[model samples]
Target chain A: MLSAGIDIGSRTIECVVIEDGAIREIRQAPTTFDPRGQIENVLAGVSFDRIMATGYGRNLFEVAYDAKTVTEIKAYGRGARHLFPEATTILDIGGQDSKCIILGPGGKVQRFEMNDRCAAGTGKFLEVMAEALNFSLEEFGPSALKAGKVLTINAMCTVFAESEVTSLISRGENREDIALGLHLAVVKRAAGMIRRLWPGGPIFFAGGVARNSCIQHLLEKDLQVPVIVPDNPQMVGALGAALLLEEGA
Target chain B: MFGLFGSATPNSNERYGMTIYDDHYLGGIEERVIRDTETARAAGAKVVGVYCAFTPKELIAAAGAIPVALCSGSDFPIPLAEQHLPRNLCALIKSSYGHAIGDSCPYFRATDLLIADATCDGKKKMFELLGRKRPLYLLQLPQTSATAESHAYWLGELRRIKVILEEETGTVITDDAIRKQIRLYNRLRTIVHEAFLLNTGPIPLLSGRELDTVTSVAGFELNLETRIAEITAALGEIKERDKDDDYIASVAGRPRILLTGCPTTNRKVLHLLEDCGGIVVAMESCGGLKTVGGLVPEQGDPLKNLAANYLSIPCACMTPNKARLDLLLAIIRDYRIDGVVELTWDGCHTYNVESFQVEECVQATGLPYLHVITDYSENDTGQLKTRIEAFLELLN
Candidate 1:
């Protein structure tokens, strides 16, 4: 059976096509304001028996495509468990929000916590700080590794953190240490959210932000647990949506 | 006077057509509140505004005063409150105090007397600020109901209020008058209980919003008989419609949720739950099914009975609120609840602290429980929807 899943996130749209329960093709593009048109363009040549949608803009395409909409939490959990069956806890830090999900036996969401209406510990927060430091988002993690001394960005608010970063630069502090401090701030906020629930067993990290090796390493150090990242962390939600097609959702 | 018959829903032409009730009869009561208060005021009746259900409404009624509730759930007064209290205080308290101090709420202006219960620390201080701007009475409630001493303390508080009421109205509160008011209020409680029991049906005869409106309106309406009649007639329509079991069977499969939380006078979460495949079968919030419906054992002494009835309400302010947990478990069984959703309003320390106990109680029954901590801000709508939807999927 051919099944497809599309994730219309705030920052990106990910399309995953599965054939006979195997991932056939994965594609991604920056999400446009017109999500339906963007999704159509991304999957122009792709065909599937059933289509499912999940993410911030999931509803925008649900009626247009006659697709079933699943919560990003559930979609990420399904995708993570399928990739790493032994994974019990999944932490997905996306553009606008971060989520910590505890998956129970039978892949059920036992419990979960999401960052409240703030962009403090999310990909957007890093994007803002990266812009302030004149570093590409992709270079943030690699540059932070060169720091000798550790620093902590106390303000989790993106705007406040950017000001704090500017002040650190004004004080002639090491740029690498400031970048590392910002990463630590994000990891600390993420750790605090994860601690609210029982964070037992292996932790799987997914989402667009999962590509940050600095965040991945800091999360492991702060949490005192090994973290696992999928081969394509960003496609987890779309992959999970495709997997749900067999369940007749 | 706002016209009642064939009244079009305000802003019905706008997006979301904000109707108070699906039933026209009960919806009429929303508009009738202002008119009813005006009529009572014109008839030389003193209007008493109450902050919480813990204040004995029957006592105020027995004093020949019309008792109306003054709690505001809208965000309009919140900015006004920020001028007085810090923005970090509980939303409900700020809303009430704001409406009173800002001079925006007609109910607050019309109230001849305002009784503010010291249910939590936030309100305890907020009411101090409110007293400066209005004719406010502060009732110090005991934090626990387990001991005889606390009950006696509460009983004395009620006696003190009765004297104050008598002084305000220049009329003595006789035992006969008290008993008469008790009987009438007891009848009103019976009707509220019947409406609550309607939720236990295969498909709830009343939506959480409708039930919340009726119960909250019960506190504000001076005429208990009229409100009782309207609710009973509305219940009749429901029974008539629910005679078809097919529709009930279809809706019965949805997850039955028991909502216990910070005073949710606003139906935002309740409507959202139903919108996301879960039906709120029971609520234990202030002015909700649990606090508003329980009878005041009419056989006992009127004063003691009223005290027991008020204190019997297990608010989060009380320590070791086992009665609340017991009541929650009983309703879970009676309503066949599939899950429990406990919502703690932002900065409400008492409810936030008590959520642990409520979670343990719900978990002991082997039911899934979701603890939603939120404020009145619209920013969390999508996040909350995702949580509720994911929870419903887990239930399935």
Candidate 2:
């Protein structure tokens, strides 16, 4: 049997096709205002017996593309567990929000917490800070690693934090120090959510922000626990959507 | 189709997409409120506007005045409120203040006296500001009710309110009048409690959203007898429909959720949970079953009865809210709730802090609990839906 899954995230859309419980093809693209159109080109020649959708725009896909909808939490849980079978907690930081999901024995979500209507702990926040600091997002992580001192960025609001960073620059604060402080502030926000759940199992980080080495390092240092990042963390939601087809079939 | 205020006609079902079933239980609820208020005013009855549920409604009713809840759940007046109050206060507070200053709430405009209970810090300060525009009475509520002296202090405060109501309305309130009002309110509470019991049945005859709308509307309806009769008839009709195959299939085996947190005026959060296959079996928020939880003794001194009931309503503002925890455990067991969802409105520092303690208490029962800190914004709808769906997935 063949099945296809699509994840319509805030900033991106990912689709995966699985045939006989094996991943056959993986494709991704920038999410457009019309989620269905964003995936139309990526899914040009792909067809499957069933199509499932997950992520921010999952609800839109059901009526627009004749697909089934699953929440990103369930999709991420299934996808993270598939890669790391022993993972008991999954921390997924997407473009606009961050979340922590506690998994049970069968990879079911026991409890979860998400950033509350704030962009401080999200990728968009980092992108804005990176632009203000005149550094590409790719250079944000590695540059922070070489900082001489970690300045404190107390303002959690992105706009306030940017002005604070600019003032810090004017106050003769080192650029590397400001970059590291920004990374620390973001991770601190994410960690606050994680500590709310205080999951006792292995922590596996997923989502677009998990690719940042600085965040992963800070999380491990703050949590005093080893953090695991799966290969292709951004595709976890789509992968989980595909796996749901096999679980029920 | 006359509005509760008796000035405007009720909107058509097509405009609200209201089904016949919705109309049966909750049709023209706001209209009924206005009509009830207008009828009471025409009869030379004084109208008292109350902000907190902890205020004894029977006391105001005893003074031959109609007690109406004045908290505004409307979003349109929030900007107006922000002009006067801080921009980052609770949405309900801002909305209420805006409605008062902007003259949007007909109920507030009709009120002869406004009673504000210092339930939370934001409200306590906001009421001081609102006093500039209206005749405001602030009732001091004791935060810790564990001591004998505290009970007496609360009783004394309620009596002072009773005196204030009597003075403001120019009516002498007899003890017999207070006792009669207590009995009437007790019957009303019974009616609401029975309606809540409908949710505990194997197949709930009413949805949580419908139950909330019905009961919360009852709080505003000065004519309790009519409200009770309508609710009783609606439940009877729903009980009959509960046997339908499709209705049974729709609700059966859904995740049973117990919502405990701040008042959810906008029911989109509840609807989102149910849409994701989670049936809300019970709620402990401000507008939920707590509205009916104040069951005072029918045969007692009016002051003591009112005092006991006021102190018994466990608000998150109270330190060491053990009563709330006990009540939550009882509701969870009685309703067979599978999970608990605690939502704290943004900038509601009291409930936001208490949510962690609630989480700890609920987790001790071995049931999964999810704490969602949010506000009345559509931006977080997808996120709230995802977290609730995942929590339900844990139960299944």
Candidate 3:
């Protein structure tokens, strides 16, 4: 039997198909203005017996395709546990929102917290700050890691932080230092949410934001614990949905 | 078939239990009451507008005046209110002040006098401004309900309010009148409380949205007898439908949620919770079970009884608010609640800070808890949905 899971996020869509217990195919695409069209493009030739949807646009996908839906929190918990069986805590920072989930003994969500209607600690904040500082998204993380010292950024609002960055630049502050400061701000927010849920432990960090090396390094250093990142962080939700279907959950 | 409030008639085929007392009927009643209030006011009937649950409606009834809730629950007048009030105030205060100054809200327009309780700083300062536009009376409520001096001060405030009511309505408020109003209000509260308790059964007869509409409309009804009859009939319909095996099976396993926090006047969070597939079996807010759960002593001094009953309301404004935590734990067990969702408005510092103790209390009972801080706006609906859905996942 084959199972499929599609995570339709605000910025991207990830589709994972698994046969029996092994991954068969993985596909992804940008979720442009027309998400339905983008979703159709992502699943062009994927075939599966059972399918599930999870993410911000899961309800729309459920209605349009008559498929089952699960919240990203549960999907991430299950996905993280499947990848690392001993994982008890997970932090997922997607494009528009971030969440901290603590799993029970059997990989059930015990408690969770998400950012409240803001882009302060999510990948979108990093993307906006990258543009303001004239750094490519690819180069943003490595450049921040190369800074000698970190500048302090107090504003959590994306718009205010962007202006703060600009002023710092005009004052002849090092660009790498400003980038490091912004990364530190995001890391502080994510760390605060995780700390609120769990004590010191290895955290399974998964999402598009986890791809940024600066955030991962700062998170591990600041929290004084290992931050585990899977090979394909963005596909965790999709993989979890598919695995849940395989388990007949 | 009123056009102003849309159709007051319910589509017979909507849902099984809610066909009798749905939003259409409740909304129609609101429109009719507004028109009826205008006619009565022109004929020399006095109307007293109140904002908080602390305002003793029985006192208004004893003074031979109509009591109407003037607390605004919409986002429409907020922009107008922001012109005078700061944008950082609670939405409830902003909306209430906006409706008064903008010449909107028929309930505010029909009032001969407005009464406000000094519950929070935002509301107290806003009442000072509201006094300029209308004949407003402020009740100096003691912050704590734990002291003998506070009780005496609250009783004195009630007595002063009685004098103001008599002077405003030109009617003598005797002890006999106060006792009669208390008895009538006690009966009303009992029926409403019973209606809310109907959800405690294995399967809820009415959804949270339907229950909220019934209670909100019942709050504004001038005729206690009429309100009691309407709600009693609705309860009968729900009870009869609860016996259906198919209906019970259809809604069997949804997680039951208990809401506790600031008054959910706007119902944004309530709608989001139900929309995310969880059943809000109980609400501990002002407009919910909190106001109706307690009753006044019939044999005691009527004025002192009114003061004591209203003072013990367990609102966040009261320091040493241990009563609220106790009430929440009782509701959680009695309602068989699977989780607790506490919603505090953005600027409501009292409830916002009190959420810490509430969270600790809920987690102690081995139930999951979620604290949501938001305003009456649609900007965060997407984010709120994800949070609510994920919270429900914990229950599953």
Better of 1 and 3 by TM-score: 3
- Which digits, one per residue and each the tens of the lDDT, describe model 3 over residues A146-239? 9999799999899999889989999999999999999999999999999898955799999999999999999999988899999999999999
Worst 10 residues of 3 chain B by lDDT: B1-10
Output the lDDT of residue B133, model 3.
Answer: 91
Give the total clashing residue pairs for model 2: 5
Per-candidate interface DockQ score: 0.67, 0.70, 0.91
Deviation of model 3 at B364, angstroms: 0.3
**Candidate 2: which pairs clash?**
B4-B31, B4-B34, B4-B35, B5-B34, B5-B35
After superposition, the stretches of candidate 1 with alpha carbons farther than 4 Å from their true spots are B1-24, B201-203, B217-219, B240-242
Model 2: per-residue Cα lDDT at residue A137: 86
DockQ winner among the candidates?
3
Q: What TM-score does prediction 1 earn? A: 0.93
Per residue, candidate 2 scores C-alpha lDDT tens digits across B246-288 of 5576567788889888887766677777767777778888756
Return whichever of 1 and 3 wins on DockQ: 3
Candidate 1 residue-wise lDDT at B255: 86
Clashes of 1: 0
By summed lDDT, which 10 consecutive residues of candidate 2 chain B come out lowest? Answer: B1-10
